[model samples]
Target: MKEFDIIVCGATGYTGQLACEHLARSYGSELRWAMAGRDMAKLRSIQARFEVPSHVQLIEVDITDAAAAASLAERARTILSTAGPFANVGEPLVAACAHNGTDYVDVSGDAVWIRKMLDRYQEVAAGSGARLIFTCGFDSVPSDLGVFFLQELARERFGAPAKTVKGRIRRLVGGLSGGTLASGRASIQAAGADPKIPQLLANPFALVPGFDGPAQPVGNAPVFDPDVKSWVAPFILAGMNAKSVHLSNALLGWSYGKDFTYDEMIMLPGAEDADSAREAADANIWSNVVRALQIDLKPGEGPSEAELAAGSFEMIFVGRTASGQEISTTVTGEGDPYALTPRIVAECAVCLTQDGTTATGGVWTAAAALGEPLRRRLEQRAGMSFSVA
Candidate 1:
């Protein structure tokens, strides 16, 4: 028997603390969960601040320590990690869980690092019955599951699967977390330092091995999309989000079709968006992403709670069936995207520990691993809603 139902590693970080708050406020003593990090002092402070139930364990976990990670993995039925640039500290913990049959989830956007995990541990995880779901937060959950939701709707409405799905960022208001920026910088630095890494990062099918689909839309440039009739700017995280969606398709036995194509962009209304405006808009968005990736910030530092509360995003996905029937679905969340991440990821941890999940092991996407059960949980508990548009 596991000692706890869930163990939140890196519970002292910015988003990690929010996850701690959510558990304390939502489940209290009803849940068997732990607040874990490398520092016991910081964990104690969070415990004091949140008044985490006395029964809730607080354990120090240094992901680098193989023995410590194994012990934690063995004791926890589920693990949610809020730490990143996971490429640096995630391997040991992930390996431990995969080897020990403990489910794991993380708000990771690092496709390159995930690719490594897939190569090294996918088989091990499968054999051990560990369902490692990555990008449980805003980066790919909304995108990956958004596509899954649309495709399911397509099957029901059109009697065929969608041949393509275009995800549009209808509205997004939030600051990127310092941890996200740090992850981006680390990825950039690693890519620059290694010649082969850029090739993998640039590939649209980076997460899926042994198969490459048709050429994808060049989501890198701004274009006037007639479908949405808007001047769309390139979304910075589209690369990461799209890969997860593609992996879901692969894992779901190619249900979206082998030639399925998907893309994402930030929508700008066409009323006044001309070539010049699009150019300016693209520069502005990309510059902010570039700045965030280059600027350094401490791991625990980020926008104030008020700022995170001010952030929000809406994603609209349009799925086109081979018969030309189109189905649209919208996913909206309040507060900053990062502000809402803890809720999504926390629910993911809880979802994995529940009675009706984990079909098999291996690195998986939310679409394949959790699906409707997860969707329902997000709708009911995370203040996120999904609706046909």
Candidate 2:
């Protein structure tokens, strides 16, 4: 039997490195975990960066090496993959875990890939006792788990769940990873490779059950009403986040509601800062330019420590129940969005492997695997918190 409780696959990568660092700093002596990747030198360097116990092993394995991957899977109770543009290489690791009964999580925002994986290996994971979770990062955390929190808040206040839940990025200033950009490019490339892939990406109900509606473009509108306190813009993250939360609702059997509708927008502080809201609108322009130029901030290549220290984000969610009662919540995290995502992802990995509170033997999401535990953990440990407003 393997000695470690968890394996941080792709540990040489940016986010993976951060997870390793976090684990070493916070849970090193206690949690039996290892760093894994195809590059043994890089893994050794990563391990050297920290003063982890000698017992923390380093496993060499590539996603393409089926036997090595299976051996890697067999060595750990759970796997945390930071490998990106996951559509290309994610399947192999997921498949290996499914075959080996090892739990898994990844910082993938590729909903299309996730849907395909669930369709292909959900049963395998269930039978093998592996609990697979995707979108364990900032991409879906605020949105996926935020919606879950909103529904709970709504039910507590209005005696029922919300019919429409809106998640808007209130204030955000952050960076992106080369890995994430690569994933996006790969997704686009894969979409181009197969014309049907675009349609799959646009499928609203692709992962959600009974969601047969047409796809709506992200960030298409701006308005305000009584549900929340401020104006709303097209929430750029809504496309992926909504699907994740909805899928969880579907898999959890209407915990949120069959009529549950989710949209994301940017929240203006108080309807008084049109300029700031417009600045928020123009925020992703540079990211778009970077994507176009194929320029990415790779591992150890992100914003300086000073920049990360200065960056922060705020998200507000408004929920309206069937009875017309309303409730609201906010999720705020300080530091660079890209940087913080890895921290959340790492903590989520730790929670999955060490928390001992999640369901067993199935594919899951942040909302399903950690759920309330995640919310509290983020609040208590990950510099994120949620509260009614």
Candidate 3:
């Protein structure tokens, strides 16, 4: 009997609907999956709109209801969640999945919450065989996996790992999702309530508990890169992505090197212009002002299909070996980050269910848990391209 191969826990949300649409289009009859949320009517409505296979189930369960979440977790081999501002609604499902030995994936980029999950559930999930992976979406996947891809090449070409890798966002044309904004607000509130939370957020090694490597480059300031020939500014997701990369390095027994150094920034195209350089330097401050005004999208709101279709992103990773041999690669994708995230999250869950990774349970990053298998899935199954540049 085919129970659900995967369960999408927030199927009615904007991103959730995109995931369902992708699953319906890609796997229809081949995969047994379900749409789950607190509202049966909403789930059923989304189910009808997607034209998924008749076998696709609709599950009604509130994140707040521990029993319902646990029961749902027990029925599926993997649970892929798009629910976020995860600090509020994520723990119960993590607890349920850890206890049930069911694999789980989420697109959350909340490092603070993720750190707590690692401390509380990593051992339990490891003991129970539940592989909980986070930041499966655009926020950290490209950054994490870009470094992974570079290190793999370094070992192949130079017969050694790259000691330093840089992730630079070349281009990104997309709007932020309301869920992302909400999460940002929640994180700020958390940091304000507890003074130490900001320190955790600022720590380059926050995710790699008990091990701190050498001092990392401060990517928060704008600087010119001689190699890339462009001015770079702090990438907003750098801190979170750095933590994920370091965690992956730790999980892989420090194969990337105990002294691995990573940083991320956004490339400023017109940086030769003095005005543009100044603007790039102040981008983070201006962004914060905008966010403080709370003038962004709300939950269940997002770009139109045309806008989503037109959006795209390109990321470049530059790897430098101990001997200073450098190699570069670019990861590019079509569609908005929000639109693409669902596919990424869904495919990750499918990879876990069908491929049955050799990785033992516990908290995992995309590169550490899925690695080349995920890279293949993204390139082959999703509309993404990765190439040496």
TM-score for every candidate vs. truth? 0.96, 0.90, 0.96
lDDT of each: 0.86, 0.76, 0.85
Give the per-residue Cα lDDT of candidate 1 at 236.
85
C-alpha-based local distance difference test score of model 1: 0.86
Q: Which residue segments of model 1 deviate by more than 4 Å?
A: 269-271, 283-288, 294-296
Deviation from native of the Cα of residue 227 in model 2, angstroms:
4.8
**Candidate with better lDDT, 1 vs 2:** 1
Per-residue error (Å), model 1, residue 299: 1.5
Over 1-389, each residue of candidate 2 has an lDDT whose tens digit, in order, gives 56678888888887788788777877768888888887899888878876656778888777776777788788888888887668777788899999988888888888778888988998898898888988888888878888888887777777899887777776787765667666767777787889887776666567864467433435564565345667666554566777787777877778877777777766655455556555544455322333333555553466666777788988878787877877888888978876678778877877877677547777788887788877887887678878786
**What range of 10 consecutive residues in model 1 has the weakest lDDT sum?**
279-288
Candidate 1 per-residue C-alpha lDDT over 106-189 given as tens digits, one digit per residue, 9 for 90 to 100? 998898899999999999999999999999998789898889889888888888999989999878887766788788888988
**How many residue pairs clash (N, CA or C atoms closer than 3 angstroms) in each of the candidate models, in the order given?**
2, 3, 0
Considering only N, C-alpha and C atoms within 3 Å, which residue pairs clash in candidate 2?
85-183, 219-234, 235-264
Model 1 clash tally, residue pairs: 2
Q: lDDT of model 1 at residue 252?
A: 93
